[model samples]
Target: MRQIQAIALVLILGGLGYALWVLYSQPPLQLSAGQADHVSTQTAPLAPVKAATDVTLSAINTLPAPTTTADAPDLTPVSRLPEVNDEETYIPPISPSVAAPAYHGDLSDHQAYLVHQSAQITQLKQDYIAAVDKKVARLESLLEKGIRHQLPAEQLQEARDKIQGLRAMQAQLRHELAQ
Candidate 1:
């Protein structure tokens, strides 16, 4: 019965696909007469080209030439220019007093602050490790309870995997703490 139904479904789908292909595969139909006329009337005619003649050439040549009189600046080559003296555009060095403020902080106090921040970071790592240990313990307990209660094997396996991952994370954190 299922085979008969499947064969009929395939035939129906094949007919539908063939119909769609026939509908879309052909070139578009010709436009209506009014649309054709509108398209033809909308096209613009090309402009005529101008012919070049001796008169046009002469007009182009008759433009005024540029003047080279005293009003124009000299165009000396760069290699021929004179060297500039340092004194002519001198910038004085900044005074030591003005630049020394940035280096004035106490290094020992900054060292102590950095040491305190390192202690805080270490404490946070330890706290995270403790949390992970708690999670591992809870997951282990759940796994044991699930086994005793005859829970689904998949659920028991998932609990086991989660506990293993949490223990691995704790081990990594402990290693980092040792560093």
Candidate 2:
């Protein structure tokens, strides 16, 4: 029991010594000499100067006075003027109007033209779709009969070129129709 008590006292003394060493031996937070001087100068207040006074009224009254004029031009109203007709005025023709087309009764001629163009566009679309279907069918038939491989390379390239040309033409027609 005495040995254990002695060991406990030694540990307590060691811990207290370590605590004191840590408290005193560590370096303190520090600022440079220039920084310390800057802080002190910044905290100081400036000296006050003498306040200014208002100008005297007698100094302003001694200046030159402006002259008044009585010979200013008169602004009298003018008399009413007579109305004048100008020859340059444009007047539309009142008689002998040209007759419009029979198909363009109340509807505008442009609108009729647009409707006709729309019908033509529809027909073109149908024709293009039919042509595309025919080409697709021909391609499928050639594929099924295995004749695509049997044909010469040049002939096969030409067939592909023809289909591509037809597609391009169809696209151009569609673009025109859209416009």
Candidate 3:
């Protein structure tokens, strides 16, 4: 059944394609007699050649010469890919190894501000890391002594959970800062 359906579909498509080809591949539509007459009358028929003498060598010589630069159209550049030459030398670019720029001019306002903000951000990050480290150390110390100091089991567990949370937050912060 599927094979029959597939064959039917192929036949239908082929028939449609053939129909389209027959429609389009034929000559342009026929015009009315009046329209045909109007078109034929409008177009001047070429004169019958009596001899090749109409196109003489002297007539060719009398024709105006091709225009030079001044009269010609502005030669706009046509953007096309450069043709590769097999014989041309291909010098590999130098790797960015240590050559510093000669211009040591004063920094623009934006550049200076960027440098200042970067330093400020670095300092702020350092301050944050120091604070987190202190908190983590304090928590660890507390956890170590929680049982000896007669802290309740629930309280110790809560403290332990808090330390884990803080450590995770610290790790996340570090990851963000690294990025």
Per-residue lDDT tens digits of candidate 2, residues 83-117?
44465233555998654333443455788788766
Clashing pairs in 3: none
RMSD of 2: 34.3
TM-score list, all predictions: 0.34, 0.30, 0.32
Q: Summarize candidate 1's per-residue lDDT along 62-98 as a digit string, tens digits.
A: 4657776776788898999977666543465586653
Models ranked on lDDT? 1, 3, 2
Candidate number achieving the greatest lDDT relative to the actual structure = 1
Those runs of model 3 whose alpha carbons end farther than 4 Å from true positions after fitting are 1-111
Tell me, by TM-score, which candidate is best: 1
TM-score winner between candidates 1 and 2: 1
Candidate 2 residue spans exceeding 4 A from truth: 1-114, 143-149, 177-179
lDDT of 3: 0.75
Q: How many clashes in each candidate?
A: 0, 0, 0
Question: Could you tell me the TM-score of candidate 1?
Answer: 0.34
Candidate 1: minimum summed lDDT over ten consecutive residues — where? 97-106
The 10-residue segment of model 3 with minimum total lDDT is 98-107
